[model samples]
Target: MRFGMGQQRITRAECAHVAALARLELTDEELDRFTGQLDELLDHVAEVEALDLEALPPTMHALPIANLLRPDTPGEVLDRDEVLAQAPFAEDGQFRVPPVLGEAP
Candidate 1:
């Protein structure tokens, strides 16, 4: 029965109705729990709505961001034998990996 000014409180019966509409079966305890949870969510929404955010600029992120990418440049490749020597497993001049699609019979 508690609600802030202009805040419409959600009732247990309304919660039951919504559950029925969604084809959800809930026990009395679950219905009671959800009714309280829904009220808290609605109260939070109302609190946010009361805030004056029009003076602030809209932004996708909190801080300024810029691309830090560097131009791609060609570099000398490592010798295949040298690279493969560091690998735990290799076959036919390539890194060997476990079968991912399926296991061999």
Candidate 2:
């Protein structure tokens, strides 16, 4: 089996186990894909382990971030009729979208 150093080739059995734990139902193809994806992810983690950070003092953070400014003032808005005119199907001053929630029969 082709393998990356320190990376365990995730097996179908492990995929199935994980799918069960996650309450996911996967077909054989999906299981195989998940195994490969997990193996690649572990390989990346193994590479990260090789990083050298011994010289630098443990800095808890890189930079502090402040809240971005946003304006609360009302700005010019699109006219409802103008906006609704662009839709292929609009109902009563609103854009019509495909029903996701069940509609009354």
Candidate 3:
């Protein structure tokens, strides 16, 4: 699903049509580029169409992973009063910031 699905050999004319639909005016170099690209893409599609999918189990995740955990521990807290003392504007127990906007018209 992430890659190729259907099988179809791409042609230069189809590349031209796609370029026209995308509003692209391709030069000879660009047209050749797109032609090769489309051909390769279709070749990939043909490859995917040849897959044998009779035994693979479909799953939500690719593989299982585990994590080791440790118990929570309290740590030393910052001195709020000391921090606020260095603030440009501090009121009551919290640091005050400037208003973003003036009164609306």
Per-model TM values vs. the true structure: 0.60, 0.49, 0.61
Against the true structure, candidate 2 has what lDDT? 0.81
| Per-residue accuracy of model 1 over 25-93 as CA lDDT, tens digit each | 999999999998888888887779889999999999899989889879988999999999999878999
lDDT of 2 at 21: 99
What is candidate 2's lDDT per residue for 1-105, written digit by digit as tens?
Answer: 456676476777987999999999999999988888898887886667778979968765687656678868999998889888988778877877867875532
- Tens digits of per-residue lDDT for model 3 on 40-67? 8777766776899679887767886566
lDDT of each: 0.87, 0.81, 0.78
* Higher-ranked by lDDT: 1 or 3: 1
* Candidate 1 lDDT: 0.87
Candidate number that wins on TM-score, 2 or 3: 3
Model 1 TM-score is 0.60
- Give the distance in Å from residue 95's predicted Cα in candidate 2 to where it truly belongs: 31
Off by over 4 Å in 3: 1-8, 65-76, 102-105
